[model samples]
Target: MDNLRLNLGCGGTHHPDWVNIDFAPRQPGVLGYDLGREIPFPDDTFATVYHSHLLEHLPKRAALPFLRECFRVLRPGGVLRLAVPDLEGIARAYLTAVDAVARGEADADARHAWMVVEMVDQLARHVSGGEMLAYWRQKPLPAQDFVLARLGAEARLAIASAGSAPLPPDPAAASALEIGTFRRSGECHLWMYDRFSLLRLLQEAGFVAAEPVAASFSAIPDFGRFGLDVEPDGNTRKPDSLFMEARKPDAPAVSGPRVVQVCMQHTGGAGSAAARLQQGLSAIGVPSFLYVSSSAGHIPGVAVIPAASGQTLLREDDGRTLTHSQWPAFVQANRATLARHTHRPPGLELFSESETAARLSDIPAMELAQIINLHWIGGTADICRDTAFLKGRPIVWTLHDMHPFTGGCHYAGSCRAFEQHCGNCPQLGSTDANDLSRAQWVRKMTAYRELDITLVCPSRWLAGEARKSRLFRKKPVHVIPNGVPTDVFRPLQRAPIRNHLGIGPDDFVMLFGADALTNRRKGFAELRAALERLRADNAVSGILLLTFGSNTGPDPASLPCRSLNLGRLSTPEELALAYNAADCLLAPSLEDNLPNVVLEAMACGLPVAGFATGGVPDMVEDGRPGRLAPTGDIEALARCIAALRDLSPQDRALSRLHCRETVLTRFSLPAQARAYADLYRQLLEARR
Candidate 1:
């Protein structure tokens, strides 16, 4: 089969050098085939398999089995090339058109119509002949002219020739015959794909190397002989198609070392970030394991190892399970230390001076891993005590909040005491130079002084803060923003989502939430003041405020708008739907790293309006996605919200598209995984 090449679902395109197969024998030499069933070819029968815009025509359930069949039929080291319409590129182009229309750079009517056609016409256009043709025939002259403008010279000439020649008798009967042929043509797209989902699917189907390539670019020898990739004028058949290739491995490949991610609890914002990273790493062929103290529920693909069993340790060292019988004493010591801080703030953090629980290094998964990633190890683990045991291993500490660098406070708020040295702690209401906060700071500094550790901050703002901290000032800090699964949190129909949320079609919906709404750092009071200002100024009416998170704040009736309290949506799916149900997300955080709410909302195609604090400006691009007011400026915040409300429909649509594109381009899960993979490789190389 050295000279053999297979072109499945070739449609009307044919090549003499390749076995062109399609469900319908569209050409004289084409072989009749159906991709829904297994191919008739023997194992390892072809040197290369090429298919363009074919896989999406099959049902979603048939995608994997069909790909596995392709892998089965290909010879060792053989290539599989595919080209599918790029959903991301299409969405981005639609956004561009919407922006142009909003700016008056393009005619709104024509551009909007073109965008709608580009988005769904391929899927909705009937394969049975005259449905699309009939619709086009009924369009006005200007609309028909616009369609002709998008066609190539050859296609235009063909259309002109056909128009001049066709004056057939019984045109209705002729159309009926053509429609019958078209009904059997198998030309509808059943499923869609973007680069990330397609890459994961290819890897799952057993392709050793799957990567996207430029259109008309291939590694196959004499690939152009098939004439499958390009049009007669040498341009690509579809300009916006995602061209990709995968190779069957010649031999079994060596796998990389497993990643063991340690976090406090497998829930909350930090827990979600860690879990998503683990999922992403696993999808990209890295073995990932997660060890947590407690879990909200079962997490898929992560092996959750509980660090403690009540007061007993669960770790095994030297084949002996270490039991923390003195854990009760340690808890009492922790309470005594916390009791010293008499003036606790609304949201207070207190850490034990020392940890007497199971050492993380003694865990089986930790011992087996090549890398130890620490994330938000507050109540579950101790950095001062546990990190000392990880002297020789590569440790990657991901800062979820300020706790890692600060003196036990989750956020410093207006306190810059952690920058120079933790002393006269305000959060703990201590005037002593060596308070509990200072002691914790000193312990952490001494414990991690010689450990091999690299710090990863999810936002530039957080990284900057870490660089200022005394404990992590000299540590290697890398800024890697948290990622969201765009596939899961993608844009959904707003009308249905809003209807499901019991919101009126004309109401302006705004989302405000966090882990705890009453937490001072979350700025719920500021949001309430801004809403009141908006109402007093009569800047917005018919407003629906959707507040989520723990119901710890003031009553919803206190707000000036009709309000709904969702009460802490715990899952990403539920959160995604909530994001889609709203027009914009309001994040009035006084202090934050990279808030996941912004990323989640943007991924769901919801604009964000908030203060220009922390990493808010990094995610929300002022006028593009939404407006950002100066920090703590309630009136300015109110005006920003009103501005978003007053935006034209086209501009709002543009903002929604831009928000989704921001996540798709920068904060995708695959991008985060790839960044970590690079960092891991670097760390491993340095260790050697």
Candidate 2:
């Protein structure tokens, strides 16, 4: 502990004198560790430590414990140095620029714009890079000298490298939700800190004599020689950062309260939303756990619930004759009844209950959780039976659809029975007053009636639906849009992806995706009609249709254009490839709660042409990035698709940027996570 050094969250800087660790290391020998998590080192191990530009990414609640962790791993008399964006300095600059702008000074307007982005972008950016990145990458960058003065060497190097480097092969295509997860995994700033807050945090973390230092003047022995904070040109590595140092004071560390996000599959909208919330919470210093019916467990802090009776259950519809373990006798009995009762009209949208209840409440993680959030729990949790386990906890349920508030329907498409008592169910073609839908509704009422639960819906339409439901009409409902990682699903060079896909540069490629395109609500029928209209108009000659996901009814080749169906794009890179190669995405779903495709496509700078129904209006602004037609209006949809395809090159480029901007500002994972964290805090306070 006397002479050893540690560099935590070391992005690119490395020294032979120090042990380097980062969440995403850019160099060899730099350990990859989640920065806000517990440090993997013995107590009193290092003589000196440093972390740069990391403190602000942590939520204020988590910063103290993280500092305390640094204090604990550090030896007595050792020094801990940290650098963060100088909030006070930025505010002062912002004010000065405002005054200059008011006086109509030269470059003041540009300076003020940058100052505003500097103040707001990182904190508010839902997508990776956000508005600041957009600003930096602008051609003939605005206010170049003023920007360079504030951003210093780092920005210059990035801008220089970007300008000089050829557009290389994109290696970013990786995961389905890769874009929305960036800031939560440590790229975005969660909370800003000034000199005062910095000192207070260090002191609270059990440090002593916490004081400011210039990058060239660290208290660490011979620190100026290392060039860790200061560059060879004598310019600070991060000019806007406030560098500070404090002593260990022989202290220790611990962490804050815990949370668990309970949800269904990890692949769909609800699961992805729940997973992102957990990620956001984890980033901000809360190690929020995820409890799911089943998962790949790729996410940190995820706990896949054990199968029923310790045996993996093969879940199938009522006609299924095989499984690894037979579902519970009662479950099988219920499935048989549900099958017999469903003598309804065909073409209804459904991917019915996938799993039987697993007593996840008995798990250790559940017991340790101070709060439990439920999302898309259909078929996974027995709402009525699981009430006993869920009752004592602070419960939050996020509606992925109308399922939670309705009688067994994930979407009550054209069915308003849920608003009443669900009698005379049209889904079942039953006219009986005491039909199965009514029975299920009664059970839901009994389960939810007295339970203390808060509800969240991702779209305003869904929020209104939940509020209108008899079951949740009295429950508190909040609207928080879904978040997707923008980094993975970002703008890519169209030429390379098109060439690789054997597509001519002049071809108009329209992409469409969904769980199962055969689902009537996914609007494949409507989409086909629109495509046929384009064919009749001779607009399909240069068009290539790209479709993904399972299609059991009609093959994609049956569409009106030359078609390629890349069934179920399995990787983030693959999705990125599809997005980059396309002229526009056709999200023709008639009913959806903020479909991930719209968000992901926008994030990738691919405009979306879809029906202006459900949450589509929330995403697609006609003539901005994409256009929307009246739902079921094939002529209007064809016109809308053509409108997106026919944009002038200049307008198209701006639309692409605007598409990315829309998601970055509205549906970032961190923002959703912050909102949930705030809600959780309020609930916890009430619980206490």
Candidate 3:
């Protein structure tokens, strides 16, 4: 009896015994067209459908649709078998080798395992929870004996020399080679992850029940005895390679509320979000913790589990700390850090002096309410070894910048190296700048793929960039602009501010600052040129150019005007006065992420004139309260300055009122807080 079995995405490797199919019809015995375009077959056409090594290559936009197609074509009680590389298996193999290498028993298999670990680590850089495993799939088929043998010359020389140990594996080496590094049965495999993340992705993809099809029967007796059950399938006659059986139920499953823990390096952006979220949960009474690195002191309300408090204190210096847990994740994260750091100690110790970090908890399938990830894993290659941290959590990443996405640069202004995968960073003067380190952005991206996480970008520009990133492409992304406390920056009547700043009524002040005068990205050069053009205009008079920053000499010596260097004013009120006293504010930045000063300037009723770069447009209204020059155009900037000089007192006053109103309506703290509240409620309800 033909049970109506099928093979999907068969590029030329169709099983002769089954109803074979291919997206490309040119192949022989092609049964259908593109899996993404449409499912050509009828509903319940096959009782069992199988896919091998084809899932990861599909762009995220098409993955879910393909899954639905597969489901549509299956019988009610039919099985859908998906055979992909097991990230958990590879991660386990890599970790075992890492453990052995640490113990000083680095054999050929151990060395090969370490190299794979390095590759996984490199891919995990810059991302949070499950990103690293998205485009790449991990499989723990037998290592290529031929490749393992090739390590002999490189492996033997290092082993023979006692004083000269082998150079550690290059984490970014995979990025240097094309995708197909080691092909197994015609499939090109890229990365591997742990069990937790893989399971999370399956569940998130609408799979009702995802059961791991064990390959334990083929495992060595020693490995098989290590708490893994060996089961044999009579029909397939082969060990299922990390396959899973998932179904879409008629109705969704209900999950309970959970406790989420967020650990980060510091108390800024990421940690602050965690803190705010905890406060939100506290309002409704959900358990949450925001943990930060401490030099010595602990935050009052936050539960401070000191690194010194952990069972194993790995490294302790330079604002870094790693501790062990009752389980493996914390240990792996720390052990990797210790090994990497100890092998190459720097001028300063990297760990914090006050506390020890904790390890991953032993619990499996944690009903975590949410995950907040903001730790900067540095440019070392050990973060991949610590995938257990996200085992049972639904992650939420607040990407402040592209640092974790692009090999550790706070700003990836012109570098697209991260687009392919980072290594040999040109910024680092390294040949493999494009490589993402195990502890760098690539690894973070890889790890982000495996978690059921929602990604949050603080600025629209950042959010857009995150969409282009390989790690964040699959996740639900939201953009929530940063907010400011408007009451703090409220406008003071101009007369008193002018009096306090000792400015006469007749003084026409042109204000600019919050940037080094010599920096190119700030458009200081254009400011100087515009000032010269303003000074030369016969209609303008008594112009006092008030600048706040380093009084680097003007870029253009031709500009003739009285210049004041307020030089980094400390007080906000003082800044407010400067804004109020000025006839206009000038900003000419090349790139910005919702700069606070622009909003502050508007809130203080100062007219702004600048380039339309980044989030500056969200703040400046072209010809209303202020003028925005064409991006990078100095001539247009000069015209805006002249226009401001011509504005009547009543018109200027109206512009100021409009500017203030824009902030109150769109960018105030209350509005921002409300948006977040709505988002949180919506997300929570969806899960329910």
Candidate 4:
């Protein structure tokens, strides 16, 4: 008998050699069925299964189970070929256009117009009618009209020709035709895919080997005969589609443990640390994967798995920014639970009662990982609720803050309720014995009962805090300061950097930065007070305070010192330059767990001055590389700043060398990675 082949979600495209299936079959001989539901075929039935622009239509929760069903039905060595629109490609195109406009290589108006079209046109266009196109022509955005006005007559003609056949002259008739087409077509994209995410999903579905393939290429025998790979005109149906092919193996088995590093986002302090660790592990001949909720750039030598996608932009109201794979209804329910707290803080908090997203436990990478190294997964991960998934796994949670041990609060300001049992939490402003904080603590207790978690603190202060926590009192905690790329942040000629920023060599520059400078925990108010004191005392005459970060606090003109606000720098290179240009780095954080800013600043040979709070003293040695004042002592902080300024040229030079050497010896990337690697091996061996 001829090999049985399947073409799932085939839409209007029918293949004679394959059983073409679609939820809405418009053509003859095509089988109609919901692809979200289980496949009806018996086990090991088909020699091949294929789908194009189909997987993204299913909700994230159903995607993997559907794939598993496909795996169950495929015969040994059967090929599964998939084609989906690439989110990364679209983002790249949008960013490229923006960059071109910034570089003056393209007209700003026209480029911006093209960028919006490139980002949204394909995803938001009317599926079966020309209504969207007509609406665009009638009321175009400024950028859109600019692009259209610049298009040549032939290009306009081609666009007109490509549009649907002329609508009926009667408005009612045209509306009917459009509605009819819409009813017959499957229109909305529920998710988006990039190469890394798609490949990871394929592996999760039990495919032994999966790799990207060209649109015209297929491993399946006589694939072209079915006319399924391309359109009737011999061009690809979706030009920018990402095609991947995977094959089933003869037997299924659990692979040996590898390293999977999980983080909330692939940026910021936590993200950078996780990425560096993965790179370090890879350098030492260990396989590593970095899984993030969202990412804009691909890390070299690390397989980056972004759970979210560009399609998220279309579903902004869904509240899935942190947990993209979650169901909309579940997100709503979770948000409702958070809303019950009348005094909840402004930022994100996950209080979901249940898990309704694609579980990481289902991913093959997680299954193969001997040790799941977690870093700053707060918004994207639910440790209390996801316990079932992590029950048997060995977990190494690197605490970037107090959130892991506390009741949803990233830092427990002065609340010691966590030392025993979290209740009447101050952060939540709840006095009830069974308030959200207490409930969360209870859930954590239950979840962690069977979990083998080794808590890693980047500072001694955080480790001590973890020991004081009721949840982690019995668990082992280790101090492992986060590492930085010393070479990248090494000392550069100060004068050149100052020249680049248009700063005078005579000016004494002080730098301050945070993800959000206005955040109360960052203590910008204290910095303000210290600056005022410095100005009053005339501590240093040519003083200039420079700030860089999102939402930098207050107006610069209001500050006592001459100030410059470099708002929200995008790259590490810019940050490094800023550090090099500065004479001293100011870190007035009220509470923190080994701030990466301090490390980067020190690595750049810049001394830091701040209150001797959590992790500050650990990095800033007293009377050496930098000075630290009493916590919350604005006057002392001002004095420390003055002391740093008063140092002679020779003493300052020695301090700079000391700062760089300290980072090189203690916080280098390889040292951090080696420590984690040893811990991983120990855990794996203990399990054996």
Q: Which segments of candidate 1 are over 4 A away from where they belong?
A: 1-253, 306-340, 347-356
The prediction achieving the highest TM-score against the true structure is 4
Looking at model 1, the pairs that clash are 313-324
Query: What lDDT score belongs to each candidate, Candidate 1 first?
Result: 0.74, 0.76, 0.54, 0.73
Task: Compute each candidate's TM-score over C-alphas.
Answer: 0.60, 0.61, 0.48, 0.65
In angstroms, give how far residue 401 of model 4 lies from its true place: 0.8
* Candidate 1 per-residue C-alpha lDDT over 1-688 given as tens digits, one digit per residue, 9 for 90 to 100: 2457888887677687776766555456565434555553444557888888888877778899889888976778999999887888778877877887788874565655665665676565544322333334333523445445443332344444544443323335556656544433566666789999899999999997899998667899977666677776686666667889999989553366557787765567888899889888878877666666555443544433322223333333332222233444555777887776677655654444445464675442245467888897655566567665687888899998887776767788789988988878888778899887887788788888868889999988999999998888899999898999898899987788787778999999999887666577888889999999988887558898887886554586688888888887867888888898899999888888888889999999899889998888878889888899999999889988998999899999989999988999999999999999889889998878
Candidate order by lDDT, highest to lowest?
2, 1, 4, 3
List pairs with backbone clashes in candidate 2. Answer: 126-668, 173-573, 174-573, 179-485, 179-486, 180-484, 180-485
Off by over 4 Å in 3: 1-386, 423-426, 429-439, 515-519, 536-540, 549-560, 569-574
Give all candidate RMSDs, comma-separated. 23.4, 21.4, 22.4, 14.3
Query: RMSD, model 3, all Cα superposed?
Result: 22.4
Scored against the true structure, residue 438 in model 1 reaches a CA lDDT of 82
After the best TM-score superposition of candidate 4, give how far the Cα of residue 332 lies from its true spot, in angstroms: 8.2
Give the clashing residue pairs of candidate 4, or none.
none
Flag regions of model 4 displaced more than 4 Å: 1-257, 300-358, 551-553
lDDT of 4 at 36: 61
